[model samples]
Target: MSNDILRLNIPPEEPNLDPNTVCKTYPELSQEQYSLCFEHPDVTASAIQGIQVAIHECQHQLKEYRWNCSSLEKKNKNPHASPLLERGYKETAFAYAISAAGVTHQVAKACSLGKLKSCGCDMSLHGKIRQKWEWGGCSHNVEFGEDFSKKFLDSKERKARDIHGRINIHNNRAGRLAVIKNVNRQCKCHGMSGSCELRTCWKATPEFREVGKRLRRKYEKARKVDILNKATARYRRIRKQTRRTELVYYERSPNYCDPNPLVDSPGTSGRLCNKTSDGVDNCETLCCGRGYNTLRVRRTERCDCKFHWCCYVVCQTCHYNEWVTVCK
Candidate 1:
């Protein structure tokens, strides 16, 4: 993952551009990935969407923490070029995992929605006889997502012959595993009116927030590992001891309290914080003890609404002022 696939481009205006047109269209994707993009444009769009989901979820999960995923939001600059991803810190581990999981979730859900020609409903469950429940509904084709992610997302990291590359690959797989683990088993009754004799079941994608929560927990307990060669005895022992679902890191995180040019971290200066709580989002912790400033701000929103007999509802605009805290 030297570069971010978030930069993958296929301009809407140029619908008939040549596949070999300057390579700028897919500067981030490998040859194989871009090749598929030319054939399956829908999949490429879905991949981008998956990354967007990952970014949104990442921001949501880290909203109250330092290094709150704001680097992925730099305008005009390549967001993937953020230093947040270059190191083997716990945040990097979570980034790789969540991005991979996001791709899996979107791709699988796309299959169920008939959005791709190459993939469709997962028939693996359709004919299976598992006790009382029969596979009936369209199950998410996670296998397709896993394969696409491996081919597309894993392409770059597979070329690197270093430990960081290995870390990215591991975290990527861990993220996909997180999505797979959260796949829900949905069932419906197929028996007589009031009798419970048989049931219909389908595998569905669980809420992406659940995946984020699981990865956040793993980030809290991420393990540090150092191994250059899989042929060595220590590597074997560590691999044997560590579960694949767990996140692994190689280096300690940077001081996120202050701006670090090396890692492109923006200090928490002026960031909103909760002054009344003793938590990660509190001014003391988030501001790095630099104190904070209080300000009264007013904002407006739709307030009271009333529905007419056969028409739309009317609402009144309301403005209110509230005191806010910002890191100094």
Candidate 2:
């Protein structure tokens, strides 16, 4: 399990780039990376990319949920009562998952795209055991990604022994593992006369949507785990049984229907809900028994496209009426 081939060649900072400014401008960069800012100056771009991608993926995944993962965008002016800091909530699980996935995907992508000076296309698998396909293409370096993500994101929990800390670390690892597990392998066939003889293959990380989908599934089946004393062997047994891909929690989540300014929950008031469906997004459930307001609106769209002449196409504009339901 040696990761000797996954090292990063972080270079000294450019004369014009200030490490302090980078940290101040992008608050999402982990403290671990900030500490090593002088050595790895180029991490600024990667950090920003990771945070943006993570937030986007989280919102996309939770679009149908009551909370909709909106807490991730909060400035956390008062960090003491941050909504996303909850330990046992499904939102917290998603936050950790996407954060890890973002960092892993971005780092590997940056390496492949030559955007970062620290690394390049994964060479770790280039000279390994013989296989049917040759590893000649630019493969996403999941090993380097996982190693760097753990070092940066899990550094805060290195000496943490509490249950919450362990839970956070576990969820973070789950996020990174999800990305690595879902890597899609693509191959190019090479032979004479279209006959299959040899293949050039490479591994690529799936879209963040895939990562979010897997994490959401994990959220649905999340387990309530017991936090036992380190002195007891039961603790070891439970830790061993917890799978890396599973989301773990210790307590029930708070009802997000009530507006809790303390936790930054804005409640579901005025939030749009589906009027016809019987799912969680249905107005009956999403409105939280507060009743819903139905409104009719004119929707305008272009339809009946027809190609005219050689270069242009014409479409007709149509107006239709539809109803939108919102929580009262």
Candidate 3:
């Protein structure tokens, strides 16, 4: 596709904002806007490369949000889904974002150099398309079905086995400490220097040393058995929980940009509602909106003197209450 066919107005310079940062900041663009921006070279080539990068980043954020929302919905329905699936979703999303970012960078680079070819139709950002395919392939392979569950279970089993081995080591250390204490006590009773006798006695008297070695081995074996038993019990409990607990994988929904209150009321309080009422009077006073309280009154005289009974609704975000009345 020729970049000229779209006849995009090329800006002299790209915006100063970082595309990655902007995408990370606002995670609520719709899928259509995201696709349109990236797929149509004209959309990005028209603006300075930096502006194009920003728009591309916005598209990535949008895709991420939608993926999250979808994943969440799936998890809600099936609580025992495979965790691998969730991991796959995250990996895939990240891969997609990175690929998209790369493509945006490349396109920006091309446009900046004035080497961009005008395409007759919307040209696929080549780098991003390749990334999408790679990530999508990974996502597909991470299948959350029976095979995935088996692998997940196998991993847990291996971890449990490792824990058992560690428990055995701890038990062995405890047993060794006990034997060393006993040996020291015996040496003290024999009037032998602790370290000197412990080192020499074992070497000089092969029979005595062999007996001690056998005893130590027995103690270690018993301790290991006990540790294994305890570990087995713990593992059983963990396995039971793992088998019963559902692993849900839900895609997070993209957050929609909060509609500008001035342009279109979000059917609720404005962003100003988030402001602290430190200087405002009656900051603690409740507002009519959801969870939104008015600033605390600075003085009794400052309190509204109107004598109408009003309903108080809490602002979902701020938990402040404001007064509202339905016209009779």
lDDT of 2 by residue, 4-120 (tens): 111122222332334554444444444566675556555444644465567656777777778776665544221213545645566776677778787788777767776566778
Order the candidates by TM-score, highest first — what do you get?
Answer: 1, 2, 3
Q: How accurate is candidate 2 locally (lDDT)?
A: 0.67
- Compare the candidates by lDDT and give the number of the best one: 1
**Stretches of candidate 3 exceeding 4 Å from the true structure:** 1-31, 34-40, 43-88, 115-328
Q: How close is every model to the real structure, measured as TM-score? A: 0.81, 0.78, 0.15
C-alpha lDDT values of all predictions: 0.74, 0.67, 0.26
User: Total clashing residue pairs per candidate?
Assistant: 0, 0, 54
Task: Report each candidate's C-alpha RMSD, comma-separated, in the order given.
Answer: 7.3, 9.4, 32.1
Per-residue lDDT value at 22 in model 2: 45
**Model 1 CA deviation exceeding 4 Å by range:** 1-27, 75-79, 190-198, 227-238, 299-321
> What is candidate 3's CA lDDT for residue 157?
31
